[model samples]
Target: MKQNLDLAPVGNCSVSALIDRCGRYVWACAPRVDGDPVFSALMDGDDPEHGFWEVCLADLKDVEQAYIKNTPVLRTVLTDTNGSAVEIIDFAPRHHKHHRTYRPVAFGRIIRPISGAPRICVRLRPSADWGARRAEATSGSNHIRYHCTDLTLRLTTDCPVSHILEERTFRLETPLAFFLGPDEGYDQEVGPGVAATLDRTVVYWKDWVRTLYIPLDFQDAVIRAAITLKLCAYEETGAIVAAMTTSVPEFPESGRNWDYRFCWIRDAYYTVRALNRLGAVDILENYLVYLRNLVDNSAGGHIQPVYGVGLEADLSERIVDSVEGYRGMKPVRVGNQAHEHLQHDVYGQIVLPLVQSFYDQRLIRPGSVEDFCALEAVGDRAYALHDQPDAGLWEFRTIARVHTYSSVMCWAACDRLAKAADALGLADRAEVWSQRADTIRARVEAEAYIPEEGRFGASFGGRELDASLLQLVDLGFLDPMDPRQVATFNAIERDLKKGPYLFRYVEPDDFGEPETAFNFCTFWFIEALHLNGRTAEAREIFEQMLSRRTHAGLLSEDIALGTDELWGNYPQTYSLVGIINCAVLLSRSWTDVR
Candidate 1:
């Protein structure tokens, strides 16, 4: 029998390949942040029969893949059945080194074919909501026009268009193609092409990534996460999106899903620090610059936990129930409703990036009354009820639990406020914030840590455990060696651990169904185990976790246990970061966890 050949989309590891029945390639296209999706696998699972990008089996067997070292230049080597090979490289070249997205704009993109003179065939089928609308295709000597609804796509290239077919009927074997930036510069629609713009994209990605100062050992996935982070960061505004998609379910058959393409102030804190740890000080610093700008603006009080990629604070959801789920998770939601939730934790989440940028780079912009007011306002919110139940870090839609994690972060908000104020000479207010911070700390120690149980609870006076509490390593509240820290870590290992995987929490998750093991929780476990002197165990589990990635090293938020299918949202930033941070930490020593 012939050995089975699989074309892995995420191409990082061998095991996590999300193989369709006739799996070939996957498609990803997220519209302007607040805009509705143009393409979504999260809305419906892989339907290779009607996918946007079709992969030929011959392309799988004959193709070799690698990135241009130190950059995101995706290079693929394809050998035609006629016994000739071709090299194709893809990347989007931008004028600015770092883009800070404030308003949505078209990206500067290009794809170049280099090497072997084999005839190439390509198809451009741009879909709206799972091939819902049929685009009209018209041919020009140098371009192909595809129009659907209000959206129009024109494909132009230096490559010759030999066998041209239209929207539903077009297919071609050409040597090159150019995706225009704007109609303005093209003569009868001429812009950048494959041959002329290759070098530009190559230099852009490599140079931007070269600026990173990564501190720990980077594995394939860790490096990939760092690169993914770069991709999600809008060059126009320093805001980094939490993920690259909307409506991708954590579990496929459930109605539990939310949009992740927006810049979340809470998530942004982790993003900046993680990026900073890699030595990309510019991302956080510039992002801080953007935040300072927001802080100074009068509309800062209208702050939501998240914002559109363009900084348009307006966010609403639509139910596209007609579409199916990715692997069958459903009733797809397009906008984020959490945008309207009164998340008190927002105060701490925003404060972290502020305090970190100040500490990591001494990057305090010229302070103004507005900045002071934003800080004071957030600080005022912090002092109101450090010990009370509010939406925790998980942001569950049901009744609020007395989440210890939320309370810890609440304490963090007050602590950072006092720290920043004292550092900058707000001496009088320092005591007030200091007292507030102390009160939260006392509350956590008194009510959060349970001595009889020899462990910390996920919420106040609760018996359940959550992986999030492991975050104290980053917060400085608890040393990894402390008994409660060790106890908490051990407790997590006992409850959250299932084989090699970890759950987000041991409690009931309201996401409509149980998901494949949570991705970030797994990484957090590795970090906890490693920090608590379980390095050997952490290393074993870390190595095991890495083994599950698809051929391209891509991962989803959850993974199915039965078939080990890559489930949840695709290419989660936090998951990638967690894996990377753990790999880096372990590369130094597993003796602590050993």
Candidate 2:
């Protein structure tokens, strides 16, 4: 009964919910990914009875949970000491209907008796105002409505409404279906409608997975990672969330927690890149639209590192004292303050994802010359601020420096813009961008590189080592075999590697030293090893990282070095991206399938 990130996520890209191991709806945001948490038990600490929904079986003895293969649909079975059992299946309905994707902001649950007669109690206690109070309810004959401060949710169920409303236990005689969605009347019968939705959702996910060009090995892992990444995306606005939940600390009493429900340009770029590798161009296509809108709105102005999925500008940070933090850590935050930080590398992240549309013929809407012109605006910003001191990709609040990674990403912006121009036969613009890229590269080589240590430091004229530097080769900033790049890799390993994991850095930041190994950085190390021709070693470490994933085959942001326990946000997109990228990097090619 301990709280953990060992939860399964079910969503349709429009709405998502995190269900605990025992089939409890712990966290779910309504309206959108960044909206209010209707079920806030995940962050309620010790007092969880008010902000959760669950179906409890009397005399429960055993339980089991798993996804319905290649889909986000989850199935959980509860068995009691009397040998009676009941099965619960959960999902958010999404499928192609009426020539368009029909994804509702809804969740569907179907419960059926698997053996003998099982008695169960339906406990649906939603909260409002960040768990300050329980939502008031009004019930109809076949449905019950919970009215929160901002919105009202309707639970339409075929089960005895009185049983659910009064929290009474009932004997399971027939299958029951419950649809929690917008406060609207459902058109179809609950049982048949939910069963049909389940069938369609399963088919939709399986069909989507079939299109992916999976590796010969770890196909299941890669597919699950890909689906989880897809779930993190808000399809309505084409924005991808960093993670589903917020305020989950990086370590115990670490005070390093932040809300990750919004989209970070850098994280979204990596997510898009990984999915693109698997031939899942739909994500790339959707994300490109999001980036294009972001660029257009900026109009060559400052761009924040993160933004609301709906492109809201100001995300002032605020703490919800109503709910205690995860595990009573305190200060459960809603909005993120990092939106105001000057993360200069966002310019390159903007351009990196946009540059692909110009060349990928599979896209329904390819990049136009006008799109290239808009991107040059972003490239201009990259060139103008390439050397300026700013918050690095790590989002250090109290420190600002001329991070090498930021400058290198600026170089990449200009470098890719030049290539994009060349593809369009705009030699003049190409020359302009190419020269800017060369100038930035020369400055980085001259200032960021250390002669005595023979490696690039985290910041210009600074000697601190950072794991982000491991991305030099992956970012096209340096050749994998470059002696300088190799030296930096060695120094990072020597300084930051803790057994099978890699810490982002050893130096203390605003929250003291990082207490856990960053999951994504370890994957970067694995990629570095593979690129350096240490295939056997890389594969060994990759397997170790795989072994560290949660029971749902997902990873959080950080892992405790000593206990190997997951910390930080749940189902982190960055960690999931690492899984797909490393599998693609280390897996045998399809030619070896025989």
For every model shown, the clashing-pair count is 38, 0
Summarize candidate 1's per-residue lDDT along 116-165 as a digit string, tens digits.
44544454444564445434566677766655333455656553544435
- Model 2: runs farther than 4 Å from truth? none
Highest lDDT: which candidate?
2
Against the unseen true structure, what C-alpha lDDT does each candidate score? 0.60, 0.93
**Which stretch of 10 consecutive residues in model 2 shows the poorest summed lDDT?**
44-53
TM for every model, in the order presented, reads 0.84, 0.99
Query: What lDDT would candidate 2 get against the real structure?
Result: 0.93
Model 1 TM-score relative to the real fold: 0.84
Residue-level lDDT of model 2, residues 1-594, one tens digit each, is 568888999999999999988899999988788888889999988557688989999999999999999999999999999999999999999999999998998999999999998999999998898888899999999999998766899999999899998999989989999999999998988899999999999999999999999999999899999999999999998999999999999999998889999999999999999999999999999999999999999999999999999998788999888888798887688899999999899999999989988999999999999999999999999999999999999999989999999999999999999999999999999999999999999999999999998999999999999999998898898998999999999999899999989999999999898889999999999999998899999999999989988778999999998799999998999999999999999988888856
lDDT of 1 at 26: 37
